[model samples]
Target: MLQTEFPFTLPCGYVDARGNLHRQGTMRLATALDEIEPLQDARVRANEAYLTILVLSRVVTRLGDLHPVDVRVIEGLFSADLAYLQRLYVQINEVGTTLFETQCPRCGLRFSLDLTEGGDINDASAGL
Candidate 1:
């Protein structure tokens, strides 16, 4: 099982047409589950970080007019968000049940096992 954590905070600001800065209360951001899964995969951690930056770039594009500092802040927040998502997937897998397919070491016969909600092993074809 993998355990991870991430923290994030939104900043207050937006750029004006005259290149002036204005103070704002909060910013709205959309997060997707699919976008965060690769981040959870240990083999692709570096790639995940790069993908997160791409997603942040899309957010900045949507904002239309944001100062460079604001973009940096947003990037930090998105990174934290990705980490949080990774932690969530780990917790879910820890509690959820899974079915396993196995082969007999003696005869090479394939068999399936079902894991109950409580993690007990049972023959997958018992009810069939």
Candidate 2:
């Protein structure tokens, strides 16, 4: 079955007003409206970069104890955490699968590979 939501652990996590750390969360697959409606938001209009904030707020279903993650919650996220979520969003929505860590047997180096891209895994590594 296709997965609609993904669980994640923030690298830096979001700190609430009470000094609570929210490291774990779940983000649902974004709908067309989630992507489109954010474009009309005044905040996004004022700052093109704010689009990520809005889009994330809509797709994130839960964060720690927070039930309905909103723009404020997203804005509170540390830069590292925000970047992590952004990468996660793209992986699930665009790539259709989460990245898996693999070790190169010959080189003995660790790397991540997107298995859903099809073709030979070696061919995919060539482009990396």
Candidate 3:
């Protein structure tokens, strides 16, 4: 059976308090309860945008040199990394597959990008 979790690299990476650069991490697919429970958090309720940080902390299990990921870790991530993980969370859980459709407005080209374990995000050109 394939693992429901997937590994990813932060676009800008995270820097710990000790100045260690942490880039690689794993995120598991979100369950209904996972999405629902965060809504009850006072922090998430106070800052709607903070929901992403909360959601991410729950799914991200590990990061470079960080055996046990925590909320503070997610809170310390760079904005670019936060965005990347948000997209990744959607890609893995809600998108429901390893491939997604993309388009280039300049050329009116629509293509499918593979998001599987070994595929690259920019490696897409298949016609639907």
Candidate 4:
């Protein structure tokens, strides 16, 4: 979360019997909601990318966004919440079509998962 509050102080131009200007500091609070436009835009873009993947995978054909089929596809793979899925989508977009290396826990063979637009499986022997 981001803090959006700031404070300011100003001296009063009027003087008392002592001929001294009075100074006071004022406190105010501003919510980040007013500055969330860019974050909201980014979230919308992430959702769009997730929906595109759903469409490509035939999870939904006609809807502008995810449908029951898409939900089913997601549920089939991971039982995660919408926020988690959105974050995952954003991370995947950031990774952007590269071969990421990982070792198989079961066989101890090093493999690479291509983070491409379409999932591509490469053999561990490829050494990519």
lDDT of each: 0.39, 0.80, 0.78, 0.36
Between 2 and 3, whose lDDT is larger? Answer: 2
For residues 33-108, what per-residue lDDT tens digits would candidate 4 score against the true structure? Answer: 4234334455446774444334222312212222322434433332232333333233333324365444555775
- What is the number of residue pairs that collide in model 1? 0
State in Å the error of residue 81, model 4: 36
TM-scores for all predictions: 0.22, 0.77, 0.76, 0.24
lDDT of 1: 0.39
> Across residues 4-114, which tens digit of lDDT does each residue of candidate 1 receive?
221212223334546654332212232465356545655446564465445443333223334332435445443444453333233334445244434455774444445
Considering lDDT, which of the candidate structures 2 and 4 is the better prediction for this target?
Answer: 2
- Whose TM-score is higher: candidate 1's or candidate 4's? 4
TM-score for candidate 4, residues paired by index: 0.24
For every candidate, C-alpha RMSD to the true structure in Å: 18.6, 5.6, 6.9, 24.1
Ranked candidates, highest lDDT first: 2, 3, 1, 4
Worst 10 residues of 1 by lDDT: 2-11
Off by over 4 Å in 1: 1-9, 12-45, 62-64, 67-128
Which candidate leads the pack in lDDT? 2
Residue 43 accuracy (lDDT) in model 4: 42
Q: Which candidate number has the best TM-score?
A: 2
Candidate 1: residue 69 Cα off by (Å)? 11
